[model samples]
Target: MLQLDLKTTVFLASIMSALMSVVLLSAYHSFPRSIRGIGQWVAGSLVLVVAPMLFWLRDIAPAWISIVLANGLLLAAVALWTLGTQAFYGRPPARRPAAIVVVAATLAVTWFVYGRESYEARVTIVTFAMGIFFGAQALLVLRHGGRDFSARFFGFLLAVQTLVVLARGMASLFAGLGGQTLFAANDVIQTVYLGSYTLMDLGLSVAFMLVITRRLHVELDILSRTDPLTQLLNRRALYDAGQRELAHMAEHGGEMALLLIDLDHFKHINDSLGHAEGDRVLTAFSAMLKRELPAGAHPGRFGGEEFLVLLPRTTMAAALALAERLRATSSRFFGRQVADLTISIGVASVDKAEHRLDGAVRRADLALYRAKSAGRNRVEAVMEAAA
Candidate 1:
């Protein structure tokens, strides 16, 4: 059997930690700027790389430098990991509290190093503090991270690392800190502790990168499908979704409706109030659609100043009522927020024999043209052929 010594394990762990830090840095530079938390993770991994090197220095350096400062770096690394998790979830990183905890833990380790020189006390304190941070990471992921494989994998790693750290802390109380000096004993507990720490160091670094990559992919997907300014489904995505919905309704024998809306005199608003004000109006209308649209309604930005709404299992009458409601509310909203603006909506329902979404949209477009031709700020509907 090949035995792994504490010094060899620590040295290997330091090398691996530095390599992982490089990997994270590369990913941060290569990936989109929208992905968060990689910077903090990189910072933590670099700190971890330094920490094990100091541990390897041990007797060559003073106790305060090798033990206290090294342990302080370890605590700081955990704190940074916690902060990274928070940043990934778009939550505020309460830096003051984490900084306070790291400072206090370092002071406690310093006391054990110089004041009394008890290895057991120092190991116990450091392990317990580290366990706390690991536990926090796990809990945060469980609460906020979505039900995705990357999230679960990362959370599980954090949970297992927490258990390992806590077990080491408990073992330190009974195991007498390995020997007169730290890592002096070649016992089973010490060997397991060092081996597990190294494994976890590598595992967690990879896991953090996985989480960041997954988020980057998700952001890119959303960006591709959504309008940049309004954050609604873009024209292509809207058409795709409409086709899918229409196919489903065709197979299931259900009615569907389309509403084509155009903001009246939108160009005038942009030319007069500036494009910035026009964007605000569009964003506000998108928000209103998100809040006011009924269940089973899909709203999208078809083009500039034109929006589309798809209503599944809806009749022409119901679609007209909904359109009126939207027109009235939008008039009031824009009146208060921007200028006295109004919208014209054209509604159309699917024919029982027709399964295509484009036909309904075309009819709705015609109705919208009529609405604009007659006057602005009104609701019009083209009945299905069956009706």
Candidate 2:
């Protein structure tokens, strides 16, 4: 195995951390601003970049500057990492609590430097503090992080770092730091501790980037499939979902139903009340669909002021009942802003023998036309199979 002196290793680690900060900063700009944690990670990496340089200056510099300040900054870096993890998960940051913890840990390190002068005491204190920070971050990610490979990998690395840090703290408290100077130890634990810090720093930075990239892809996928205004599935997604359900029915011998809905006199509402209020009515209707639909129902915005729903395992009778209920209840969703808004619906059902959605969709459209012609705000259905 290759070996480098502790000073050289610390110097290289500082250089590596500096380079990692550059990478993180680049990522911060590359990712969308809404992503939240890249900025904090960049700050944490920059802080870490300074800590090893201070550690390398230990003998030449005053103990307060090299030991106390270095350890304090180390603790602060970990606190920032915890904050970044919180932000990544969309949790409110515990800034005041993290500040208190970092400050208290720094004070403990300072007291040992100025008053007690115990090397083992300082090592134990700083390592334990780092363990707490890394452990908290690991918990936050592992518990709430999405079930993706990048998230699991990132959380796993943090968990490993937490265990390594806590193990070192225990060794310092019980077994001692092994020598007067950290480098003097020439011990396995010391080498592993320093090496782990450097490698974990690199691994975690890359892992965080991967996590952010994965999340960006997921968000973009959702954006492509959903309507921006109503946050419901868009036309393409609705068709795809219906096809899948149709395939399932073909195999399982079940029935499927659809509802094509239109907001009555929506263009008048837009022209009279302006697009803003028209948007409110659409949003209210979408929210009502989400709240009132059954578990197996798939709802989407078909177009302007038009929505479609595909309900698997539902009969035409059940679908018409649901449409009636929706028509009756929709008025409650809008306030005085659009008090007179109403919806008309067309319901159609397909049994297992039917394989295509277009025929059913066409029939539903015709039914919708009839409902609109007969006077709005009524439910209509086409019972016959389309030839």
Candidate 3:
């Protein structure tokens, strides 16, 4: 393997970062609109690459380009990174604060280029700003972003980067940083500082990609298990939960009951009030179920106009009362809008020996059918369901 020095490492790192940014930018365009902040990240990464390249060209470039322009772009990139971090987590960016910091950093650089030309002053200002913005990004990740390993790692990296950058800024004053540009570093401290910055670039890029991919996977899993309309667990998830609940009941002696519920006159509402109104009714009823279900109830959408709830450590009488409450609430709520809007509920106590969700559900479903036959707006028990 070829040996590399600080300058060579920085150069290669910049190139790699630029390449990664470009690839990510292209990928950002391909990502769904549901994923936020990719555009800001893409733009910020490009600006970030430009900052270092300009720093490297300090000897050849004009003071305005190297000092003012480079620092401005660097701060801009940090602002964008903060914004991107917020966006990735579906949170709003701290625009006013970021804008203030960017302006301050750029003004400090402008003063260095035009007035005092003091490298220490410029470095202090820029590094402090970087530390603050990096800290802000770390906060964003921990606050609203994913709690997965990759997300946590990214936040930790940002926190460490913040401390290091701030320490660099503080140490620069004591180190007698006279006129040392980023590239023309004479001491070990400057070289180490630059090296750390390069490593930060590499680490954050990899961490953020992992965070994005992991979050998407989590969201896809949720989408698969949940019904889009009612925001309830879908049939698969319901059955899965039922199976698990039964297993738990086998181990721990607990009474388990199933409630098979159907919206009464739902087809008529869809036909008379239109599908849009019917959808609203479904959503309202879903909200009601969420509010009215007993504590620790496992509610799921069984199918169209049908829902199931599993109640563990609950009696048939308690289940009946809860079902009655749901029916009364539904009647009072939907009755005003549509006269015949009501729900039929059927309760079936799961037999300890049966050990199956399907068998329990079948009994509850028969009870539901009985409720439908006997005037459509009442609760029926297991025996009533059998008839």
TM-score for all models, in order of appearance: 0.95, 0.96, 0.93
Candidate models: Cα lDDT each: 0.87, 0.87, 0.83
Q: In candidate 2, which residue ranges exceed 4 Å CA deviation? A: 332-337
Cα error of candidate 3 at position 237, Å: 0.6
lDDT of 2 by residue, 1-387 (tens): 666487887888788889989998998888888788888899999999999999999898998879888988888888887898899999999999889888998898888878888889988988998998899989999888878999999999999999999998999899986455777646778788888888898899888888988989988999999999999999999989988998888777778899999998889988998999888778877887999999989999999988999999998889999999998887555444476678889888875677678888888898999999999889999998852
lDDT of 3 by residue, 1-387 (tens): 433366666676668679779877876877667778778878888887888877766768998887788889888987898898888887777889999999988987798768877888888898999999999888888786656789889999999889888888888867767666576546666777788788888788778888877777878888999999999889999888888878888898787888999998799988987999888888888888999887888888899889999898887888888889888998998877678788999999887776677788888988999999999989998943233
Model 1 ranges off by over 4 Å: 178-181, 338-340, 385-387
Query: How do the residues 153-217 of candidate 1 rate in per-residue lDDT, one tens digit apiece?
Result: 99999999899889988988876654655565556766777888899889999888888888888
Predicted structure 1, TM vs. truth: 0.95
Clashing pairs in 3: none
lDDT of 1: 0.87
Looking at model 2, the pairs that clash are none
Model 3, stretches more than 4 Å misplaced? 1-6, 144-147, 383-387
